[model samples]
Target: MEGRIAAKAEQDGAVAAPRRAPSQQRSRERVERMLAAASALIAEQGSDAMRMGEVAERAGVSIGSLYQFFPDKRAIVWALAERRTAEGQACIAAALKDVGDAEGLRQAFSGLVDIYYGLFLAEPVMRDIWSGTQADKALRELELADSRANAEFLVAALKRLRPKADPAELEATALLVWQMGEAAMRLAISVDREEGDRLVAAYKRMALRELGDG
Candidate 1:
């Protein structure tokens, strides 16, 4: 559950950062190719079985070049996961903004659930990457940081909805909602599609009702 949004301290050795940051356009393009290759391999098989050399070969880059940007397979997975998280953050911002009433808030909550669930269903690689986070403490920490970031977006919206509510209380509520929502999504993906949709719908209804009460 915690690994869905997983930890954020990138400096930890467990996940392994890129050997060097790509600054130039050519370097960035190469990094993107490496990521795309790794993502495809992870989707085709699993991160546990994806080999660095294969990724490099698929990307049409040398193995040395792959290692230059990603020290190991975990780093590649982390990059892909982090990129997806960024996309989620943007979606969260868009879905939760401009809400000033109960109806609007409910719609926003629904949007959040639908958008995230859609992503999980559409992108199989995310499931594998998130699962890996549970075993890697560094990746888990990365998720925690990401969870907090997502929670902050929720808090911002909550602050608007509950002007008189204590800030600390709202922050706590935001984190709780986010983590549980992530857990729900994780669980939803683990089951059949029909059951998964039902689970997502149930969570959305429960969340909307609870937040509506606030």
Candidate 2:
């Protein structure tokens, strides 16, 4: 079974998708409960140590019911990861929606970094879910696509602020900066709080400086 799972992971890039998506409202709510339970357990124990049986127990669903929705632990993890990614993308969209001037853009850009970082910092499960994606090709592809999607918001803001800016340049710049910001944010959270603070502050300064100069 382990060998088969490894083979599937290599072949599909993602672990496994949900065995079945919920079709009814009741089924949806039950699935949500299962995912919520899984998230909490992941937060407490890390995804690697979390068990499917524990998730079923915590969600107050039978093992059979859980398996009906998710074929394995990886499916649950992927579901949670997808939810987090969507939330992150929505957060970015909202953060960059309003920009009146260069100063406003700069503040919004720096503020966005803080806001997104705060989400990951507050949710330990976000960190664990993120690490869970590292070994999968599909999730890695998803991450890159997500970066581009998120960068569109930033680029839109830039186009509004600098009406004369080249569209291609703005796009490439936004994509690079957003990707770097994500990497830096991950780094910022991986260390001691004091040092993390320093790193975040430095990243904000550098990013904001670039925004100002552009």
| Top model number, lDDT | 1
What's the TM for model 1? Answer: 0.92
Give RMSD (Å) of candidate 1 vs. truth. 3.2
- Give per-residue CA lDDT, model 2, range 182-212, as digits (tens): 7887888889888988998898888776665
Model 2 residue pairs with clashes: 13-138
lDDT for model 2, on a 0 to 1 scale?
0.79
Q: Write the per-residue lDDT of candidate 1 for residues 1-214, one digit (tens) a residue.
A: 2233332344344666666779999999998899988889988999889999999999999999898888889778877877888888888877777877778878888987898899889887988877666788876776777778888887888888889988998888778778788789889999999999999999988877767666
Per-candidate TM-score against the hidden true structure: 0.92, 0.89
Clashes of each: 11, 1
Per-residue error at 17 for model 2, in Å?
0.8
RMSD (Å) per prediction: 3.2, 4.8
* Candidates' C-alpha lDDT: 0.81, 0.79
Worst window of 10 by summed lDDT in candidate 2: 1-10
